[model samples]
Target: MSDTLLTDLHVKYIQNLGKNKDDLTYHMTAHLRMNAVYWGLTALCVMKHKDALDAEETIEYVMSCWDDEAGGFGAHPGHDAHILSTLSAVQVLAIHEALARIDVTRVVNFILGLQHPSGVFAGDQFGETDTRFLYCAVSALSLLGAIDRLDRERTVTYLASCRNFDGGFGRVAGAESHAAQVWVCTAALAILDRLDVIDVPTLGWWLAERQLPNGGLNGRPEKLEDVCYSYWVLSSMAILNKLTWIDSAALTRFILSAQDSEDGGISDRPGDMVDVFHTLFGVAGLSLLGYPGLDDLDPVYCMPASLIERMGLKKGWKALPRRL
Candidate 1:
């Protein structure tokens, strides 16, 4: 996409939110899926206009989504909490340098409450388990700097159960493999410091099969290409240290083709609606392709350069084993 188009889309996304007055608060009318859009949009806006937005104000709005009683975040103040909303809440705060404002211990406890004895994570107290919850749990724990709070061995074993013989991961044990599940599994393994447990070469082969002739990736073999899967499948390969196995040039072209010039965002496919969710992943995909003006994002942990620096984490950020 042209530089001018990218700039325009970014501007449009920010403008769509309109002005925020002192008494203004984000309406909590949507579910967790919609909350992802809010946090994603907030992060995108902050990145685009750091000086224009009051970082403190933006942070407070995002933090309002946290449901302290439920020990997880929700779409709005009174909404039920879930792992997905909790992850987005933390990520948006981290992006805005507001994590220090949160109660780290409480957040960690909330995340720990979602873990099942079998190593899978449920979304909340309701016990809805899925691969997406696993991703949220891993990511949220990593953000809080408290991943060790979970039973790592059990979690790893649970992750292993989700791996299919086809060299991909599934939402649950014995389920069909999917590209999104592969991303979650890959990221979780990276966070747990056990990516080696899976057969990287075989998994990489399965992921490669997702690439379509149009250059974007599909959720499964023989599926049509979509922009979101580009980040899911490509980032999984990056986490596995196997990004080179895919055609970078072709994927880059596909992502660029989905750019909506009139607005400042990307869509799942050409002629689709542009939103913050796909826009962030779309930029992330470009960053993976070594795009200029973007920092090198950690494939395993999706935090930006600033937060990584603040944590004093080593370049690769591997977990150190405890001495016996």
Candidate 2:
């Protein structure tokens, strides 16, 4: 009930999230099924409880979401292929070392085909463009070892355009800066090995300012703090090597306090209804803060540190010293 992490209860909560297919919420969240699976799986990895979710069943579920016609994965079976869900699918498969089971070439083609002449990427064939989709393309390709197929110069140019005067990146060029956009832009550049395009000091300062007196982070100025930004903001700063700018101890306490101690998950803030997205970010934020007995999270890839290291994708980002 205190600030201590309730790892076991959280694990149970994640494990049960996909069990009730007949539940109304499950069907309602079908659009986010792929992302929700990644969130749950990565949270388990960070908690060192990856076994809580059956690997074979999980892999089968991911495969089921595959869009055969488009050669990309969808949020759920029968859904149209999207860059967002495709990235989540790749992340899930990569974590389990099941990438070999997928047709990487076709998936890579599907991702690349979404790119626009302007260098930004659309979420799907319907053409909703965002810096978020661009990041997804970059990250997914990198995980599949197909980043070499992307036009690196063109991709970095688009991201550079998204940079704002406040040293934060936005959802699109000239848009207002938001923490979530900053994370994707920053992390994408990190994977692309183009951090030189980032104004590190300025963006670091802007990201640090996301922390408020309550020790939680908000997506943008004048917004209320949300637990999910704990990952968005902290991971960006971690990628920029400026994690020390914020008070980790205070933020750690804030995240812990937001956990649903009895029901087992976390919410946007303390006392809110718990869900899988916030739960993953809450735990990941703690890991980046160097919380004791937690696994390291690769801020750039948002996967397990050990896996990123094994893949030789570790960048300059540093997590706080694990207290063991």
Candidate 3:
């Protein structure tokens, strides 16, 4: 296992992802093409290599995903508009400083229209409500400078309902606690400036327990440790100002061990096939862990810290100091 980040290899891997349109995996992931782009781009940004991808072409591809009929973005050209992809579109545009390419008023309305009276948000017209969707809405709106349109009270109440007694959150109200859900709820509250909704001490304790003896994190109890949870878990701790709770050194080593030293991507665990989703989250986790030569990541937005700060969207989270 490599003890250091293979930054150059990972950059090349991301650049090659959208190539070879005939590849089965490429076709299979069409439903998430927009999100895949955001994941790859954000990973590059965290690695201090945003220019690795062509800016104008990438922005144009992001714009092409727009679902004009719905005033939102789809996962790909022909896919229906969904809140998840819409948020990905917004984030990628924000990272590129290209938000002006989108119609803010219509996109804001499309997102607000997804919110039910219950304050929970659906992914798209199909109506599957999740706390994750709620975060996507809040975040997208904030990036567009339209957060004022959100019903703060209702949104916070809905998030409160999703909080488990264990102090972690679930996909929906009354569901079991999972680290991913905890991140959505916590980060949403952080962005909404309503983090008082969380029971900090209890949540901190629960988050700390996610770390296993192997030094990786699992999403929930009894699950195997995975690379994605490194972000889901660490970002939660960072937002809560509790970075000291995790064994950062051990977890960092675990993340580096999962890297594809030969082909350049991160997998769910060691010896698995690497992909963009895990790669972004792994690099993100490393950034929060103060890995050397990496740029700071805004845990709340999962974008570059400098970009988030410049946009006036920085939240109250703190990551470990960048190591030399």
Candidate 4:
């Protein structure tokens, strides 16, 4: 109820997410099952309680979602493999140090196979392309240490085409700039060491403007603030080394105010229903803002900073100093 993170309650909340399988909401979200696991697991890690979820059981569930026929992961058992779910599967395995359980070579090939001639990636065999899928592919390959197999120049060229005059990026070439799209393109460039392609000051200014008078951030101009943008906007700013451009204290308060005091999660905005996605992004934003009693998040990869550093993929992105 206070203006502070409900750490224990959130950990318990995440712990219970997979227990109610018989609930209608659980079946309704089968398409997001893998992603929901990733979000819950990562949120627990940020809370410094990765053990809250049993590693063995978690790994088993993740492996069950594997589409052996496609060599990638599906959102849930019996679903089609997708780049988005594939990335989530990879992230969950990496966090639990269980990547060895899957065929890295096959997964890498599956991801590489999704790249279009234009260099963007599709979500799956359906062929819907977007910068988000590109990031998922890039991030997954990087985690598997197969990034060298990707066409770096072509990827960069496609990202460059998506850039807008306002210094932000869109889902595709010539589309209007959006915060979420900017994050994927910017983060993918960071993974490729291609930040040089971005107009730093111009993009930084555009990102800073996402923070509104309410202290929360909107995906774009004329949009209402959402907790998820806490990650999209702040992570991009941290990567750009422009974190100070926004009001950290105000943003922190805004995120905390959106907490589900009784139920133990965070929502898009204050008084909204809480879910794992917004909860992770909200807490991650606080960590980036230097809130006390939290772990550092690698803005570039959206993973634990120490884990990324241990793997030698840590970027030069900045986060506010953690309060003692």
Q: Give candidate 3's whole-model lDDT.
A: 0.95
lDDT for model 4, please.
Answer: 0.94
The candidate that wins on lDDT is 3
Query: Model 2 reaches what TM-score against the true structure?
Result: 0.99
* Pairs that collide, model 1: 9-263, 9-264, 10-264
lDDT of 2: 0.94
Clashing pairs counted in every model: 3, 0, 0, 0
Give model 1's clash tally: 3
Between 1 and 3, whose lDDT is larger? 3
lDDT of 1 by residue, 111-178 (tens): 88888889899988889899789888887887788877878898899999999888899989999999
Give TM-scores for every candidate, taking all chains together and pairing residue i with residue i. 0.87, 0.99, 0.99, 0.99
Model 3 poorest 10 in a row by lDDT: 59-68
Write one digit per residue (lDDT tens) for candidate 3, span 218-270: 99888899999999999999999998998999999999999999989999999
Q: Residue 184 error for model 1, in Å?
A: 0.9
Give lDDT per model, in order. 0.73, 0.94, 0.95, 0.94
The root-mean-square deviation over C-alpha atoms between each candidate and the true structure, in angstroms, is 5.8, 0.8, 0.6, 0.7
Q: Quote model 3's TM-score.
A: 0.99
Residue pairs in candidate 4 whose N, alpha carbon or C atoms collide under 3 angstroms: none
lDDT of 4 by residue, 1-324 (tens): 459899998999898899998999999999999999999998999999999989999999999998989999999998999999999999999998889999999999999999999999999998999999999999999999999999999999999999999899999898999999999999999999999999999999998899899899999888899999999999999999999999999899999999989979999999989999999999999999999999999988888888889888988899999898
Candidate 1 runs further than 4 Å off: 1-5, 18-29, 33-53, 313-324
